[model samples]
Structures are given as C-alpha cells and as structure tokens.
Target: MSDDANGRRPSIRDVARLANVSYQTVSRVLNDHPSVRPETRDRVNQVMAELNYRPNQAARALVTSRSQTIGILAASSSMYGPASSIAAIEAAARLRGYWVSTANIDASDPGSIPEGLAHLRAQSIEGLVVIAPQVRVVRALAAQALDIPYVTLQSTDLDVDHMLSVDQVAGARMATKHLISLGHRGIYHLAGPQDWIEAEARMRGFLEELGASDVPTTAPILGDWTADFGYYAGRELLRVRDFTAVFSSNDQMALGFIHAARDEGLDVPRDLSVIGFDDIPEAAHFWPPLTTVRQDFAELGRRCVELLLGPADGLESPSPSTIAPELIVRGSTAPAA
Candidate 1:
C-alpha cells in the first residue's frame, strides 16, 4: 500500500506523481523556475495544495543555503501606522509561503537600529523589510551595509529600492494646500518629533506650501506622536495668536488639539481650522469630525514584500503614481476667520 494509506504527510514526490509530472518538474515549480510550462506548474501546485503538502523547510534551506525567512526590521511600531504596516507585511509574506521574523526597535536609541538588524541576521533571514520611520535609523543602516537584499519604507531620495507606496510629502502638501485654499494664511504646523522620516517629509510639504503662497508660516511645534502631546502643543500655540489654522502631522495629535481647543473656548472650523494625517478611525468621531489624509498601510506592506523579493533596484527613482493619499474632507477644516 502507498504511504498515503497510512496518512503520512504529503511530500513533493507524492504531489509530482499525483499531478502526473516528473519529480524535476515538481522541483522546478517549487523553486518558481521561469522556464517551466505555466500549465504544468499550475497543475503541480494544485495537486500539492489538494494533498496538503508542506515543504521541508530545513531540507530546502540546506539545499539552497537560504533560510526562506524574511525579516521585518521596524522602528517604534507603537504608532498605528507602523503597527498596521507590519501586520499587512506579515499577511503578504504568509500568502507567498515565506516565514516572517519581526524585530522592533526604539528609534530614539541610536544603538537600537543595529541591534534589530543583528537579531534578524542571527535568524539567517533571506531578506529584510525595514520599516524605519526615523531618519537616524536609515542613516545607521547606511553606515552598516546590508549584505542581503533589504527593502525600506522610507523615502531617502537615495538611489536605492523599497521606497514603495505612500508619498507622504505629497500627502502633507495636499493637506497644507487645502488649508491654504481656504484662505488660511497664518497656518501653524504641529509636526512630529525630529529624526522621523515621515515627520520631516510632512514638515517639508507644509513649508513648501506656505512658501509658494507667499505666506509666512508660524514656527512649527514639534511633539511626540501622542494625544497628550498634541493637547500640549495646542495650548502652547494659543500663546502665539498669529496662526488661524493648524495642520497636525497625525490624526491622534489632531484629536488632542481639538480637545485642548475646546477647553480654550475655541470651536473647530470656526475659531480654529485643523487637519491631520493617517485618518485614524477615531478621527471621524472627533468633535466636528477631522479632515485628514488616508494612507494605504496595507498596500504599502504588500508592496514592501514584493519589492524585497523582486528586484527593487529599479524603484530607486520614485514614480509618484505608486500610492496616493486620499484627502478625507470633514468638519474639522474651514475658511479662516
């Protein structure tokens, strides 16, 4: 009797025989051999799936000298954006049948970045997906050259790949321009803390919009990405009565800003027009629902895996058409008083 009668785990040979293909053809399909006939490969894969076949990872790794494990090296994933992105990356990698290893570091610590990379290297990860929202993390990674293929989610403008989805600069610019179009000349930007790439990009976009419109911007208040910090920033801005509108780097901050403003007897879109990024779920429920930019974190994660596995070198020169943030108009923003 065949081993199948004993309810043994299915193997590649069994799948090959079931599909009526040679063992070599099965192997080619497993390795994604480009020369293999598409129909034959599909047939082999179908049978393998039907048989609930599982590849021997140890054997495959030994044969190819590859771990078949992808590493997610992330910085400060406590924030919604990074957290959501990591989850999506995991989902995408699973669909491709690759193991995922995660290493999260605090971007505030200069040494944390290297430590995360080292942890992944120890796992013999085939490639890396770096989700560094901070500029310093990228700089540190640059100092330590990566031997294996790595994909990053930050826009470095350096001729490297993995600058996938999310044109944060454009998104920020869109938010700022929307405020400007509403005649908000005295726009105050409550930006993210320094060293973060997204924070810097968003700041640049805010400044660029203010400069082009011949409007002098109020000194930006840089704060940690937190509701409490946003509240603090909002109260502090009240001291400088020059700005009529404020653009926060994230929705959490915007929500806090609104709360603070309410305490100061400021009605949103009336006494102060506010906008934010990321469009977090609660943004819509905030007092006078917030106007914010929606970033596709899931798509970004999917693309990061694709780029890491595929040739991401061609993505060095950014194509802005990749991921466009949609501006969600709500009650938070209005014409300056």
Candidate 2:
C-alpha cells in the first residue's frame, strides 16, 4: 500500500494480493507482457477494475521513452466517411492506451496543411494519420519530409509513404454498374469537387464502366458532399430532361436530389432512378430508402491505427490496402421508366 496524505492508497501489491497473484504478475499485466496466462490476465484486470486503480502514465512514458500519443490530420470530418474514420481511429487508439491529438483542416485550403502539422509537432506526437483526400496534400507532404512516421489515407498516383486508397474507384464502378444493369442508359453523374483523390477516382470508375458498355455519359455535376449542394445540383439537373437516372458520389447528395425531384412533381423510381455512394446510416432509413455503395470507414480507421502503431501478431504490412465497396440496392433505384 502506498500512503496518501489522508489514507493508505491501493497499490499494485494490493491488487496482486486480491487477485491471488504476485505483484510481478500485476506489473506484467499492466505492461502487457506476453508471458502471462489468459485467465491470470483476466483476474488481474478484474482486480484492478474493482479497485478503480489507474496506472501512472508518467512512469510508463519514462520507461518507454514515448509520449504514447498519436496525431490525426483529418479533413471533411463533417461528412460521413471522414467523420466515421476519425471516430474509429479515436476508439482504436483508446483501446491501445495511447492519447490522440487531432487537427482539422479545410482540404480546399493549402495553407492550413503545414499549420496543422506544426500543431501536432508541438504536441510531440509519436506518429501521424493523415486523412486529407486531396491530391495537393499528398504533393505537399512529398515536397517536404516531416521526418516523422506517417500514414496517408487516400489514393495517390505518386507512391506516398504508408498510404492506403480504400478503392474508391472500385466502389464507384460498383455504383455505376448497378445503375447500368437496371437499364439506365442516359445516366448523369453527381461528383465531388476537383483535386480530391476520392472524387477523381470515383469519377474515373464511373466513366470507365460506362465506356466499356459503349454508353455515353452526360457532363457530371460537381458538388460538395452536402445535401444543400445536392439540392442545388438537383435543381440544375431538372432543366436537362434527357436523363432517367443519376449516380451521386455520396448519399446526402442523393437525398437532396430526391427532394428536388419530388418538388418538381417527379416520383422516384416512377420518373427517375438515383444511386449514391457511402451508404451512410440514414441511407437505409430515408423516405424512399437510398440505394448506395458501402465503404467500411470503421475498418479504415482500425487499419490506420494498426498501421500507425504496428500490425498485431505477425500480420503483414498495412500499406497498399484498398477495402472493397459493396452495393446496397433499395427503393430509390429501379429500371428506367
């Protein structure tokens, strides 16, 4: 027992005694030493929890010579994918007993990139997870070496250090193919803004799928991934009366387009078909129920933590991974009417 000002505080020895193990066993459990048995580990953990014991982070840091902190440079966190990824990263980091420092930047603004890095640097972050989706961020990182270990979370033609693209191209292809297979030939596209790696990859997949079938595509409407822009895009698209189906880059845009179509007295699936990517949680619960592509943002975030820290249990390197997307069909899409 360690003596506090007023009373004897519970120490590792006390926990060990309660758990019927040596203090060395408690220490091993705290340090996550691999030699301990699973049942013993559970017993020690239960004892610690029962005692409400908290480890001394300062002593652990001194022993490890690490701050035990990771930094996240994320963009478009208001959107579903980025926001979900950020949450997953935070959760994963917490499980590993590491602190997270996050810096948000508007991906469109180039000036904020280095500034965000500087903020994390000041915090002495041991590793970095960069989730900026723009190509320029990749270029900027390449131009100057921060000399800190970092992993990027987007597709880049140039080989970036420890970067993973989640296969937006494949996801987009799946989205387009779904529309095409439903007999929608005159399909228009709603895409994210330019200079974004994900937007570009998705656009490429859409066009490639269409080209393979000799189906010509209309000029795409570029919009930020927002319901407001989706509404604006929907209003603009109503003037061109040729298309019977639309492929939106994300679900919020699809919802906006639906609202726009309904306002124009056009019923979904009866007048037009719509498909969107990133099957957000609300997609299934939407009025018509959206047909969308599902990206595993949670998996992406877990992979980021694994890559930033290290792969567990003889796992291979985490670079060059692209999670495949799945197509979810719903009432929002149908055969061209």
Candidate 3:
C-alpha cells in the first residue's frame, strides 16, 4: 500500500517486505511451488498486486532454467492455414498457463531457419512448435537437431515422433469422392503451389480417388493459393468448358473461381460444380455457400501443445498425431446435371 520514495519499480524484495515473508517465499510463490501454504500464497499475491510487481521472465528463466514459455518458428505465416495454426497454438498455450513467443522466418531463405531458432532459444523456450508447410523448410528445420521437445504442423514422414497435422491427403480424397459420387466424370483440380506440403498431399489424394473410381484425370493446375490466381485460372479453364466441376485447393481460390463462373454467365452447380478445402470462416458465407473440406485447426493446436507440454490437466492420453479432415457439404454442389 506504500509508494517507493525513489519512484522506481517495485522489486521482489519490496514484495517480500510488504507481505512479511522471506525473499525465498516470494520466489517460490512466483514459481508456483506446491510447498507454499495457500494462505501465504494468497497474501503474497495480494501484496504483489498492490505493488504492481511484474516478474522479469528473462531473469526468472535464467534462475529456474524453465521459461514456462513455448516458441513458434513459423514460415509463410501470412497464409491462412499457417496463420490459423499459429493462433490455435497460442490459445492452447495460454490455456496451459504458458506464454508463447513467435519468430517468423522467410521459408525460402535457408539461412533464416537457424536465425529464427536461435532467437527463440535465447528466450530459453522449453518447447517449440513449427509451422513449416514447405518441404524445404522442414528439411532445413530437421538439420537443426534441436535439443528441446518440438512439433511440426505438417506431415513430412521425417521425425514422426514430433509431427502433428491434419490429414490433407484424406481431405482431398473426400472432396474428390464427393464430386465423383455426384456423377461428374470430368473434374479439374486447382492445386496449391507445387512445393507446399498440404498442396501436394491434396493433389495426390485427388488423383488417387479419380484413378480408383475410373474417372478420367486431367493434369492439375498449380496455383499460388490466392483468389486472384483462382479467378484468372477459372477464366482460362472455363473457356474450354471441358470439366463439369472444379476442386480448388482452398476457399479463397474457390471464391475467385465462382466469381469467374458468374462473369462468364454460368450458373454454379447448374452448369459447373465447385468445391474447396480448408472451410475457412468465409466459406459458409460465399455466394451459394461453398462446399469444402474442414480441418479441425483448434484440435490441431491443442494437440501441438499437448505433444510439447504434455496433455492438459486431466487428459490421461495423448491424441493421435494425424487428425482426419471432415467433408462439409453445403450448397456448392449437386447431382451433376
């Protein structure tokens, strides 16, 4: 309740003096040590609050050798999938009473991977979550030989013990099968950039399903996972009027493709059926309400936290590393006319 005459920030000693406890007791309370009595802990917390004492996380980490922080080394963080995963991880980490520090890296620059890792490590992060969606980024990460527990959000068959992700291949297959069931033999796939892991997996699944069902397959068009690309590609592809349906890599592109369809005086599902992946928040609001594949990004984030920091308070067992994606059918497609 008293202000320091020097007008300096309150320190742990000040908190201990005000709380009538030893300096060690304040440290234990800061660390959440179980040995501290409940009443004493409450009293010290009250004093800390009254003094507005903020613990220096860096100092605490050096002394305790446990930062109680998780680091996210992310590449291509601006993209929807990676960005969503980052948000999910941060939320999950907060639920577990830990802080999150993120270091965004240019995935194209191999040199930046180590620099990003070093920056996070300097904070003494106890665990790491990697949002590397490119094969090259994953490869660059694997070379680091990190000493702490880490989890990668993409499935690359490398360090399976540390990998967690939604099953992209299966999700794509679900999309393709949905179209095939609708009696659309001529289907085109608008895939993500060739190097992206999710894009490749989805394209693979699309081709696999078409081959299995005897539906003739055409070479997929590689896209940059943008609405602009989708609109342009759709304008070009629709000129030929070859395929009855198109499965876009993500909802953004699907939105663009639908726009192009409208421009060309075509009615969706009546003349052309379109589907997309990721089931972004806007997907359901798209004109005609796009039908798309949904990945449980929340679950993926929770699992990443669990994999790195152990299951949350009451979780007795860890969830599987690979989450299955769900097929969300909306108004985007109907029986092929």
Task: Write one digit per residue (lDDT tens) for candidate 3, span 60-133.
Answer: 88788789999999999999999999999999999999999999999889977876776676567899999999
TM-score list, all predictions: 0.76, 0.78, 0.82
State which candidate has the highest TM-score. Answer: 3
After superposition, candidate 3 runs with Cα above 4 Å error: 1-58, 314-320
Runs of candidate 1 with Cα error greater than 4 angstroms are 1-60, 63-66, 108-110, 311-322
Candidate 1, residue 154: how far the Cα is off, in Å: 0.8
The lDDT per prediction is: 0.80, 0.81, 0.89
Q: Determine the C-alpha RMSD for candidate 2 after optimal superposition of all C-alphas.
A: 12.3
The best candidate by lDDT is 3
Tens-digit per-residue lDDT, 21-67, candidate 2:
97767766775555689999999999888777755543455678787
Clashes of 3: 0
**Cα lDDT of model 1 overall?**
0.80
Q: Tens digits of per-residue lDDT for model 1 on 1-337? A: 2247777877767887889987666765665545578899889878977887756663566688988799988888888888888888888888777889898888778776666666566556888888888777787778766788777777566425546648888998999999999998888888998878889889998998888888886677888889999898888878766778889999988889888899888899898999999988888998899999999887776677776675244455333235788999999999888
Q: Worst 10-residue stretch by lDDT in candidate 3?
A: 312-321
> Candidate 3 lDDT (Cα, whole model)?
0.89
Error of 1 at 187 (Å): 0.8
